[model samples]
Target chain A: MKLTIIGVGLIGGSIALKLREKHFVDYIYGVDYSEQHLREAKELEIIDEASPLENAVKNSDLIIVAIPVDSAKKNLESVLALINDQQTVMDVGSTKSGIVQAANLHKNRNRFVAFHPMWGTENSGPKSAISDSFTGRAGVICDKEDSAPDALKMVEQVAEHLEMNLLYMDAESHDVHTAYISHISHITSYALANTVLEKEREEDTIFQLASSGFSSTVRLAKSHPEMWVPIFRQNKENVLDVLNEHITQLRKFKSALEKDNYEYLEELIRNANKIRGILK
Target chain B: MKLTIIGVGLIGGSIALKLREKHFVDYIYGVDYSEQHLREAKELEIIDEASPLENAVKNSDLIIVAIPVDSAKKNLESVLALINDQQTVMDVGSTKSGIVQAANLHKNRNRFVAFHPMWGTENSGPKSAISDSFTGRAGVICDKEDSAPDALKMVEQVAEHLEMNLLYMDAESHDVHTAYISHISHITSYALANTVLEKEREEDTIFQLASSGFSSTVRLAKSHPEMWVPIFRQNKENVLDVLNEHITQLRKFKSALEKDNYEYLEELIRNANKIRGILK
Candidate 1:
């Protein structure tokens, strides 16, 4: 089947490459506002051709709106308007509720699937795309009941081709869970990098003494503001809820330290250790 | 040279394994409060034998106080009191200032070398120890001017055998730098883990949706409390200083999001991206 991937950056370009490798799609049409991304995606063979948005949507069997959450919401309306009942549309934005709600009022609503393959890196651009980026990860299809069976099935097939496990959830629930797990992590990393940068004036010390632990915790701070600012904006309420809880939690540590309550501090760390069982 | 390691946990066991591989030590005597650790270290061949503290110190040519910061401070004096001018004593604790100060008034203060290997993982014990753990990482020798030249020279040679880049600084400077680069990262990670654990009641949801980024940011939360509490107690002042700065940094993100200040949020993230140049 022919596929059109909007915003040929990391997520979109990776999906395009994986689908072509699995023979799930015969050709991929790349659409992006940036001409450089389009050229790089085509040169990297991530997509077969670069086409205008209208042409790409009209000529493809599947349309994947893989862009920032704010752009995805606006573009979802335009893509749904252009697609016929025969064409299936999907989006791979980090947050789902706004886009799902935007698509709800569209005439071609049933033809659109709200999907999020739970995988990402700090890096961006088509050059950072990898074919196995989503392998062994969860591919969540949010508000599945809102999409037509055929539309959902095509995305499920794409998830299978990408070697991802399928998960189903409501869009609101997906947004809340991501805010707790994924979104808050980015905030903490960005804040951590800033904390070190503000206080540690000597760059040479950080360069020499940065252990793997420090590097791992601060790695996500390298993410682009263009991507994250939109995510935090679209999921503002949920992000704020978790961010407040996170600050409270941190204050508990501060309180324990201020009072010289080593026992309470140990208890807090021991509680945090519970994540090892859940995550691994 | 014969070596006595006075704590067969992660740091001590790792150094023992690496030094054995380099043939720098013909015999290693493992001493730990936990007999199980000594047995495991012997079985894993991380140490040649398990010996009592007094016997181990008397028989060995060099002594390594590879224990928690609290224990290292108490044991440094004991080891120095037992060792002659011919024997060198060193430590591998996270903080250097407290222990260096504790040893300052000892009669054999010149025989003690304050060292820290800037490499570790959340995993602990002899089982987690690896011979190449310190390779290509920094080995810091603090307050070297206070130590006898021969004692400093022996520790420098040990760093070479471990294949680490050597850096020298005063103990107070090392403590301040680590509080920014290392200790604060752990607190953020622990607090982040607690934030998700406290807010997300559904454990399965976190397991299903936790991305690589979340895992990377919270990996240090798995660190053992026994090892961390002592370090925090000893470096309480510096840790508190950095922790306050970190909380202030996090508050900027909170304030920006609360006011819907996307421009400020973008600026915060862009500023954090500056760390990429320093770290990599």
Candidate 2:
């Protein structure tokens, strides 16, 4: 298949490389607004050529719209408008509801597949792309029924080639679940980093004494603002819902600690420990 | 030299194993309140023998009070009462102010060294012991002047053998710094895990959708409450202070998201990204 990846950055570049490595993609065309990213993608051999968005779309069998959620929502609609019925289009945004809803009434709606392969790091850009980015992680296909069977099959093949376990859910449910599990983690980490930075002005002390635990918990704080600020904004309601609950939990802990109620704090921690059984 | 580890749990057990592996000690005596732990320590070869607290302290050239912070404060007192001037004593508790205060006016006060090694995992017990547990991490020796020069030298020897970088600070500062850097991380993790569990009732959804980011942030929540509850109790003031600051930060993110203030959200995340420089 001739694959064209719009916004050839981390997610798009990784998929293009993985698909090519597996011999599933005959040729990959990269389309990125940033001249630097387009050049880097080609230089890194993530794509066979860097082409204009219109030229990339006209010549490719499969088009992958991989970008930030807010941008992806706008680009997905524009891409859908230009793609023929035979050419399959897909997006790998962290969010699904916005992009999916944006294309709800598109003429070639069935040609588009909405996928979110649930794996990422605090890093971004083409340099951060790696071949095994999707291995052993969940690849979510949102609202599969809305897509043509051929479009869905192509995405399924991509997921299989990358060794991801494919899961199907509607866009609404996908948004809610990800807000519960993924997006809130980044927000919490960012807040935590800010908290430590604000309260402890001596960076050297925090640097020397920080355990592996502190580093891991604050790891997401290093994520790029260009990606996360939009995510929090796009998924505002769901993010706010979880953030409110998270704040309530934190306040409960604060109250218990303030009251010297070690028993209450102990109970909260014990309840939290149940996540071990749930997660691992 | 003869070495005695009074609490054969994670920190103490790992120290015994690492020291034994390095051939730093002629013999190790394991002392614990739990008979099962003593047996496990011997079974794991973490110690040459499981002996009574008094017997262990009486025979060993160096005694390590590797117990809970609250318990270490009491045990340090009684152990100092039993030890001769030639016998050196040190502790591996998370907090130092309480332990240091308990040994304040003891006749053998000079014999005890206060140390808190900056490494741990969610797992515990003698079975969790491993070689090189403290390698490349900071091992703090608090209030070095309060300890006799010989006693400080013995603890310094153990740190070198375990390949830990020894850092020195007064007990009060150590307690305050740890609360900001280490203790607060665990509390935030526990609260985050509880928030997810309380709001997201479907355990399977949380399990399947949770990314590495979520898992990393909440990993410390699985810490054994027996170990953490006491630390929080003993360091209540500092822990509470950090928790309050953390909550305030959380509220800032919550307010931004609720009000659809992307600019404020962006600023908060940008500030958070500063941790990247500090941590790395």
CA displacement after TM-score superposition, residue A219 of candidate 2 (Å): 0.3
TM-score of 2: 0.98
Which residue pairs collide, candidate 2? none
Tell me how far the alpha carbon of residue A187 in candidate 1 is from the true structure, in angstroms, after superposition.
0.6
Tens digits of per-residue lDDT for model 2, B65-145: 888788888778889989999999998999888888888879899998888889999998988988778898988999999
lDDT of 1 by residue, B66-176 (tens): 988998998888888888899999999999989999999899999999999999999999899998999999999998999999999999999999999999999999999
Per-residue lDDT of candidate 2, residues A1-280 (tens digit): 7999998888898998999999999999998888899889989999889898888898889999888888888888778878787899988888888888988878889999999999889988899899998899899999999999998998899899999988899998999888978998998899889988998889999888888889999999999989888788878899999888888888888888888888898899999999999987
Could you say which candidate leads in DockQ? 1
